[model samples]
Target: MHDQPWTTAPLVAFDLEGSGSQDHEHEAILEVGVVPLVDGHPDIRNAYDSTVNPGRRIQRRPWSSPGLTNDVLGLAPRLDAIEPELAGRLNGTSIVGHNVNVDWRLLSPRCPGIRPASLIDTLKLARLIHRKAQPRTLTALLAYYELDDEVTELSGGQPHRALWDAVGAGLLLGALIRELPHGGSLTVTGLHTVAGVSLGDAEQTLPLF
Candidate 1:
């Protein structure tokens, strides 16, 4: 292990964009993206993204985003088809992402057996590190940390597509981790010490991460 909270832990930045915000609601998962990082940086070529069949008719109403459509998802696998693979990659890894709770809520149930021991949120990390910064979107943080060049080019073609966003998130975290004042005080026990809670706890000790 690398000694940090996520040391020796394979990292996967995952994202899920959906038609609606319900775990078991009528809406569907529009897209899912995953970028696995080893030793802090994205492997790039190994990224995964998929549009899924919701098993029901996709809403093609005016309120829907153009990107969320049956046409986009027509060729993609159903949610059930991809669940096994997603669960396998996610097992025992430290998951990092921007607004990761959304992703977890939508997909975690499909992988009921896997319990991530650690999680790092770039969104929370950004607020913690740059509380005084003027702007704080993921893109802004990328620029602030001089990481825009590394990731901006990757997501350019797909933009908001789930997988590309996941990769961008991985890049963002990689940049933030490297830019930390001293690589951050990131030991597993140390994090538990300061967080005042264990990773296996069902709920967070504090409302915020």
Candidate 2:
């Protein structure tokens, strides 16, 4: 499968909004969104978005300021309740995210036995491909690639939210793929190379705005 072209790979754009803590171990995921790539295209119509009710009180506002408060989250389903659904969708697919490691960390513990086919971080790709690009925030990359407007129009939610960011990351993947020398002719391994060999190396090279 690694030798398969990226466009044919089962890549899903995954993202989540967390409740207050910077420490992944302590924080709780408040929302999750998955935009599955259909032939390398974001399938927004079939995208999954769900708000998760944190079991405990959120100590502070989430970094994204998603406005997911106790009152709001209390009405949502707990992580375990949706674990089956989550596992079914995420288990067998390779997930792509702007800073995927964080989401993986936040999610792995909550949903055990849920493993993805691969993890492709766009942040790492930007570090290697567009080294000079300043402030590689997902929004910045989207704007630079002229995809911000289209992402906003297609995503049902707003920025800082799960669904919107998932769409942004998904489309951003397509944009970056076109920037490659081989275009859509590249393999999944080629895409991984863009993410770099060292897991945490590319992350240290670029800081999101």
Model-by-model lDDT, in order?
0.64, 0.78
| Model 2 clashing residue pairs (backbone) | none
Instruction: Write the residue-wise lDDT of candidate 1 on 1-209 in tens digits.
Output: 55655444567887777776432444467788777887667776787777887776675655454476776678778888887777787777767777666566555555566577566677766666676855567666767767666675665434456766677788877565555665565654432232222244334321221
Q: Which stretches of candidate 1 lie over 4 Å from their true place?
A: 2-7, 22-24, 60-66, 184-209
C-alpha lDDT of residue 208 in model 2: 25
Q: Write the per-residue lDDT of candidate 2 for residues 68-103, one digit (tens) a residue.
A: 777888899998888888788888778889888777
Q: Quote the positional error of residue 13 for candidate 1 in Å.
A: 1.2
Error of 2 at 88 (Å): 0.6
Task: Tell me how candidate 2 scores on lDDT.
Answer: 0.78
User: Could you tell me which residue pairs clash in candidate 1?
Assistant: 5-186
